[model samples]
Structure formats: structure tokens, C-alpha cells
Target: MASWKFPGFLIFFTLFSCSFSYTFTITNNCAYTIWPGTLAGSASPRLSTTGFRLDSGQSVKLTTVPGWSGRIWGRTGCKFDTMGIGNCETGDCGGKLECDGNGAAAPTSLFEITLGAGNGQDFYDVSMVDGYNLPILALPKGVYGGACNATGCMTDINLGCPTELQVLGGNGYQVGGVVGCRSACEAFKLDKYCCSGEFANPNTCQPSYYSTIFKKACPRAYSYAFDDGTSTFTCKASEYAIVFCPNSNGNQKPNPAPASPPPPMRRPHPKGHVVPSSSNIVLLPFPVPMLLLVVSLSFSFIVERPWPVI
Candidate 1:
């Protein structure tokens, strides 16, 4: 009888382990509300909601089954009608309140992830390959594995945004100012900036001047197209917290660089700022409340975990 029971127990455990869901908590730490957008991968399941509002200090959690992979971005200064149709300053998905499966427009920071990815590990990264709107952080909770946690951009890049890459707008407020920053690819569509054409390969596409500036501001983030070594991280957490404007002041005010140099300006653009002689360049400006969506993870074991939730 004991031998028969052991077989049944083993079968149950295997089934449960094979079908576990991971919870993701998206928190808004900025001074204003944000609309978080989600784009499911081609093979991944559709999310419960593709986009939704996340007010300041609020959080929301969503769950995904194993093998789920995709990206998440934030949209600020969004305005929607009663029908839930509208647009945003940055990370707008076809100007729709609900993004569905479409990717956000360029010049928006990105958080990409692949669960149960290669070598039985989950790969995640905070990328500025598109550009930057808000400071973001992706942290693992109670994860037991290698160094796979606490990676994101904490510095407000818009404060020091190059004049050419500045996105000036009301930024969901009454006053107009610099709301976000644009990537080198968006600012100048050259092959080197976009890492396209002959420069697609990692060897040929070395970091350029603009990428170097971004790297100096946020070392943990992907500053350029081929920033794989320090940018990508691996982990095995049952849950993750994706925080927008993480660890910001309580006021949640949007920090827009002054249009004109302030009389008492304290910070200035870095040395060798790129200035486009052509004035037609377009600068584009660029989510969620969940307390906690907990998932039971019986696989937790002792491992050399290095970082805490950031």
C-alpha cells in the first residue's frame, strides 16, 4: 500500500510543478498616474488586460504561466475619453488606451523578460535601447538562485537629456516642459545608432558617444543595442516587482527640464552635447497597482542570493 501511495504522490507533485504561475507586481512610485502597457510574445498567452491606469503610490499584480515572455512600458500624461480611447506623451501604443498586442512607439524605456528561458533560468533586463521616460526597476522577491535581481535605471535621465533628444510637452500637466529623453537611435536614425544594416552584429556595433552617455547615467541598464554583458540578468523568482519611477519623492511630480536655461541652473548637459543643425527633428515624450498576487513556490531552496528588493 505504501509503495502504491508513493507513486501517486510523485505524479501529483510533478503535475503541480509543471503548471505554476508567476506573479508580477507593477507599482507606480511617481508623482502622477501612469498607464502601463503590456505586449505578449507571439507564443505567450494573452494577458487579462493589456493596459490600465496606475495612480501614484498604487500597485497592481498580474500573473503569467511558465514560458510567458514579453515587455512592459509606461505611458505618462495620458488622456482618455469615456470610451477609454486616448493618447499619451510617451510609450503610446497606436494612441489607444488599451494596447492589446501592439508594441509601444520608440523612445520609451523597456523591461523585457523571458520566463523559464534557456538553461532553466529566467532572463530579464531593463533596456534603454528605445529611450527613456521614467526611472524603472525590476526586482525579484524571495528568489533563490544566482545573481538575478535588483536591476534597473534609477537616475532621472530627462534631467540631463541632451537638447536634441529632449521631449518637451505639458507632460500631463498644465505647464509645458521637457518630459522625456530620446535614444540615439530615435534622435538620429543612422545605422550605427540603430544598430542596423552592417552594424547589426555585436562585434561591429560597439557603443558610440550617445550610448556612452546613457551608460554613465545608468550603468545597470542597456544603453545601446548590443549591451548584453552587464544589462541582461538571470533569476528564478516566483514573483517580481516592476516599479515605475521607483523610490521617488512622495509628491510624484513630473521632472521636466526647463525649456530655457534657468538663471540659477544647477545641472547642465554633459560635455560634447549633440546639436542638430536641422530643427525638424521630432522629440517624442513618453502603469499599475497591485498589492500582491502571491503564487506558492515549493521549489524554494538555499542558494547564494546576493541582492535585496530594490
Candidate 2:
């Protein structure tokens, strides 16, 4: 027997006085949030807990939270590791692909952080186990950097829109869902970061891949930092706040240099005259609830053992 947890509620309903055949569809006479998951119309092809098929006019009252821009015409795997960036011919890639976020424009609203059934509407936190799907091709610009995971953006892929296309020229780590992204000239402090969480989730991965990705991405704390796909640039010793920029690459030789750092912790204010303007700030606005999701080997061992000859 196999059991899994994804707040997907499958409902098959039809509208209009007609009989139709739909490969996939969702229709209901009521308004119910689909797992209350984050639905951003961006470029990262995230794991969707609630994916359904529709036949033409059928509807799911997702107006309160909004579903994908258009429709769930077909299913595809994660964008990364799909051989080619925009190629997702398979149904589910099974975490083999890395995730790069949409580059053209960011999601226009607070698409992250819907609380659980018990939690209030003001509930949200960075996802340690799941993310949303973005069809980059659907964006007006046709490209993106990627959403930043707790670790970093994985890589570039097609926008999870109605078309298939490729757009690059980012640090390959802009993939992010609930956290602020680190594309362009953005900067972040690590101390105030809530990126570090479980290094692995047994519920999502096979025993082999779980151990491999976890071992590789573990040891290092998870964070959505300003990175260049080759290195994570956040200051591990200090709190961080991100400021995104348009031209982050060093090649754009423009404008006079900004004021240089005088020295470490050297403020212009007089001694003992602390100012409110330079106070501490939280990098991410939303609060996270869960701890590191990485399961220990002992926990892993027990899960695999299973019921004894039940």
C-alpha cells in the first residue's frame, strides 16, 4: 500500500446542458480553495498539489485565490533536468529537474502563504516540501531567472504557460516560491533568513534520490540568497535584506560608484546616538512555521522498515 500527502481534492463536475469528454477538468457549484496552495502566474514549474482537468465551460470557483491563468490543458514534469529547458513531454519528472524562476515580470500579488485548515487566513511560510509551476512562456517577456528555493534557484526552464519558449541571462538561481527572489542586483542578509529547514523529505523522494539530493544540498543552510548559480553570496554571519536590481552583472559599466564602505559597523551617527532609520529588518515579510525538514538516517530507517507482516 502507498500513501501520500498533497492537499489536492479531485472534483469532476460539468456545466451547460450537454455531455462532453475532457481529458482533465474541475467544476463545482461552490467556492473552495484548492489546498490553499500558492498560485503565482510566473515561470517556475512547481509541484502542484491540486491539478485537475476541465471540459470547456466547467469551473472551479478559484476566483478568491485564482488558479493558473488559462487552464490545465496537459501535464508535464519539472522544468529542470528535462533534457532541454522548455521540454516537458513527460507527465511528472519526479524531482529530477532543477527549477529556475520566471524572469520577465514577477507575480503581481502575494501569491504565497495560505494557511492550513486550522490556521487563519494570515498564515504562510516558505515551502520546505513543495512549490508551484510557472509557464515562463506565458509571460509578456517570455523568460525568467527562476524562483529561489531555500538553497537557491536551480536553473532556467520554459514558462509553464500555453506556449513553449526559452529565455536566459540570469544567475540561474532566481527560482523562488514563498520567499523573495535574488535575481538582478538583489542583496540579502543571512542571519534574519529562515531558509534553513529539512534537508530532505522522504514523503516526496525515492530512498535513493532522497539520500543523494539531501546529502548534496545539506550541510549548507537553505536560503534565497543573491547567488550566481556558482556561489551563494549572502553573509552567513549577519542578518540580511534583499534589494533587487535590473542589471546585476558586472559587465554593465554605468553610473558613478555608490559610496564605499567606510569600515565594518561604522555608522555616521554620533556615539550612543542610535537612529531608527538604521534599525534591523526582516528580509522576508511572511513567517515560516516548520523547522528543518531533513529527516535523520534513523528516521529514514524506521520509515522504510514498514509494518511487520501485518
| Top lDDT hit | 1
Candidate 1 lDDT, tens digit per residue, 158-274?
777878887886754423366678877777778877778888666778888878767777776777766767767778888778888764653744453322110000111112111
- Model 1, backbone clash pairs (residues 3+ apart or across chains), number: 10
Off by over 4 Å in 1: 117-119, 172-176, 252-310
Q: Write the per-residue lDDT of candidate 2 for residues 1-310, one digit (tens) a residue.
A: 1232222221222222112211111221111111111222232123232233222122322221111111121222224433633323222222222222221122111112111111111111111111212211100011123222222111111221111111222323222211111211112221212122331222221222221232233212111221112222111111111111111221221122211110001001111111111111111221211122111111211111111111
Model 1 accuracy (lDDT, Cα): 0.67
Tell me, what's the RMSD of every candidate? 12.1, 22.8
* TM, every model: 0.79, 0.18
